[model samples]
Target chain A: MGELALRKPSGTLVALVAHTLRLQLKSALIWGGVLGAYAAAMVASYLSFGDPQQMEQIMAAYPPELLEAFGITDMSTIEGYLAGQVFNLAPLALAFFPILALSAAIAGSEERGTIDVLLGNPVPRWQLVVGSFVATAVSLLLIVFIMGAMMYGTAVLADTELGFVASVEGVLNLWPISLFFGGLALLCSAVFHRRALAIAVPGLVLLAMYLADTLGRVSEDLEVYRDFSVFYYYAPEGSAITDGIDWASFFGITGLAILFALFAVLVFRRRDIYT
Target chain B: MCAVIYTEDLTKTYGKARGIRDVNLTVEEGEVFGFLGPNGAGKTTAIRVLMNFLRPTSGRAEVFGRDTVKHSVEIRSAVGNLPGEFALEDKMTGERLLKFFARLRGVKDLGYARELAGRLGADLTRPMRRLSRGNKQKIGLIQAMFHRPPLLILDEPTGGLDPLVQEEFLRIIGEVRGEGRTVFFSSHVLSEVERVCDRVGIIREGELVDVEPTDNLVNKSFRHVRLVFEKPVDPGPFRALNGVENLCAEGPELRFTLYDDLDRMVKLAAQHRLVNMEYERPSLEEIFLTYYGASEEEDRDG
Candidate 1:
């Protein structure tokens, strides 16, 4: 009918995501608080052991099990630990903040019955999908930038100088990491219309990936499974925290984010527009 | 006739459950046609199919000669819809919703929208969550009619308005008719349809029973006459009267409904000292049950 009514680029969908992200900016505060506490602890440990060898010794004694569980190993070393400790906490921060924001974004509209009115309008179905995806993507990037700044700001207060390069690398990890989950969250929101699943679906998937990564690290038997986990692609171990930035992994994860977002769009097109 | 809306053996089924079955209807240009039916009787489903909200299982339906799915956007652009299951964005005020609808339809000026809001008592400033259901219905109506589309596919368009507001809505429909545009409305209220619609299609259990003019229906369907007497009434004299279908006599009055002409009947009532007299039209529900019968099985068996 008249070439599908000249679909708009979905400004409304973008608007929905932007509003959701703005509501969760305090995530930066949460990320900052965690980084600040870790920085404080690192400073005390550094003061106790003035020797570089002693610093390495104390770093080895750090709870390897807990550290491994969180995908935080290389970050424990003096040079590497500075960035690792800050970026390591990102997955947790993302699992909480942006999810709370998404809970209000997708499911919230349908819960209030506003989805019916939107469906009645001339707005195309895919626009709703992509608009929401773009909105959350933009928001997740903002959270990353804000938290990155906070981590850099916290690293400055450390007695041991972790240079700007290390700090930049630490904060940069948040982009790819957050993008993976952000796309996943949008996908979940598209699938489910409940606050619990809207947050839990993506959050659990990310957590499960981190857990799978840990299990793989403890034994070679599960190593192959790591490739399937988005967590593995999120922050490639040999990248920033290992002293070299992995552009391949970084861009690969970014590409994965686009793929996840595209999947969300495709799924939304076939499914019934919720009443 | 060039039907503004029509269907050819149209059917829509949701999995094993049927939504509308073989619903074939045609509304002439400029006539106020009422697609009357009870709740869950496939009225809304049929409307949804016509709007391309749902795909038909079999048969075909077209609006302005365009397939609903292929041309919903084009057909919808020319058609205004007020969904039977009314819902609107709560964060937006009545004014904002109107503006949004107007803008969605490409209304460049707020003046026209403002005029409709004023006439309909729609407060555009307050968010939709604060407005009453009647107010919400008003907003929906304003959006539907503001564009002044030549065709309207309204599903229970006046669900929540008070009687006065309902009358106001009817008056607007009358005006729409005067402008020579087709107003295709569905409602559970039979009298409303009887009062406004030039022709009506009574639907029941996903099937259309009959389609005819309101006046012809009123004249041929049933005739009800109320006669209040000066003294206690007797059932015997009234029941024996010619053309009497049903006659019930109370102690002091007779309330009876009869078929055929009333000239001889009125003379019979005058013979017995009548205190007051009244005549009534058959309700839409009466015609509804009469035409569609009761159940799907009953209609099929008939």
Candidate 2:
């Protein structure tokens, strides 16, 4: 057989991303379908709450601070209802998909003894890190879109006041925050050899930042600490569905995710991979 | 002939743990170089260093005349590597995995890959999780050979293979050598190395102890000498001979291991009326044992 010309690093990166995304397709769908169905169910359940005044009374029984902690402003509207029911909690769960996927990018593959075979094909180390991040990012978007479509479909079916644009904005806002955590997982994956540490560090940070953000909403003293959390810039007061998407915070959070991914590439490139 | 692999004082230390140290070696182009060692003897470590999986702590190596560290991707582009320990994705079938790798290498054809799969009996349709260890080894072998790279660096290539498969693998290695491709094969199994390797480098305790042509390594080593005399002869005279050990005598039969001074032993044996005489070259495994045993005894004496 005649020799095949060597592939450029860019070609390998593209192939890596394509293969990773293919591997993640089933997972993305499962995550998206489960979360999307739950969001849709929430949209369906909103219609059974009776009249607006009765819903107001039901929401009024709960403490305002408790409501604010969960990002629930007006439970009567579909936007406010989903803001608390799905969008707020979805990221806490959705973030894990990428966290697991991206963590598996370097450290997890190393532990599994799979990296050597893949890297044996003339792939640059940076391409591995970058390809994983990009693939997970795309998968995250698919999950968010699925969730958004389900929520929107249910809203239309239930004849609720939720606009298509509002549903898109709300779901779109979940992307960066979820990806930010996923990026942190990638960085951890790059720096550490064990996949458990890669998953745990980002996982612990996810819960802690969430707690800080939630408690900060309920307590004035802790509110200052929320500024340091990625969740702080996410959806403040369940506003994305009520209002439009927060473009500044959206880009800022996505930029932070990209930054974490970049740091992952740097660390992964220098370290020795152990299986 | 040009050198395909060159290393000068290559060292890799793992924070007080034992790794390869200052190992100087060379593998010429198209030569079948066997890296022989027991487990944890730095065979894998040295191969890993050459593959650029582990950065050298000191000194350097070059593959295909390119510095291993600086041009790792380029080196890898022309090298087919089978790591000693590896895992395939549980969810992917062998066919899918190869296609994915084929895409990565920019190889347009899967014809060679399919042929290899057929030859190795690699069940390309089954997910890797379901394959047996030996079966997985077959897939690993196929993936490394399918690309037809210039250099094949295989670590414990026949680790879990059955005898028939090992024979087939040796045949494949021979064919690779015939095609002017270099194979840097590592294994603790002496017989396989003896059969295929043109030159063998024996590593022990994280250092290369010897590197020489396979024929030279075997022929230049000790021999097993047996002598049967017409009448019962005094074993005392033969026992005191230089470079002779384990001299056992029963009636007229005398058997001993001869490391050197074969001429003196022959002369001493001629003093008795010899009925039969036999001198046999040791197998590679015996030669390897003798080599290791001598070194170990020296170490103990110190």
Q: Model 2: per-residue lDDT, tens digit, B236-289?
A: 888888888999999889999888888899898888788999998776557666
Q: After superposition, which runs of candidate 1 have C-alpha atoms over 4 Å from their true positions?
A: A1-60, A74-86, A92-112, A149-172, A175-204, A238-245, B221-227, B260-267, B271-283, B300-302
Q: Considering summed lDDT, which 10 consecutive residues are worst modelled in model 2 chain A?
A: A1-10
Clash-forming residue pairs, model 1? A1-B70, A1-B71, A75-A81, B92-B128, B93-B126, B93-B127, B95-B124
Error of 2 at A134 (Å): 0.4
In candidate 2, the residue pairs with backbone N, CA or C atoms under 3 Å apart (3 or more residues apart, or in different chains) clash, namely: none
**Whole-model lDDT per candidate:** 0.69, 0.88
Clash number for every model?
7, 0
lDDT of 1 at B165: 77
Which ten-residue region of model 2 chain B has the weakest summed lDDT? Answer: B284-293
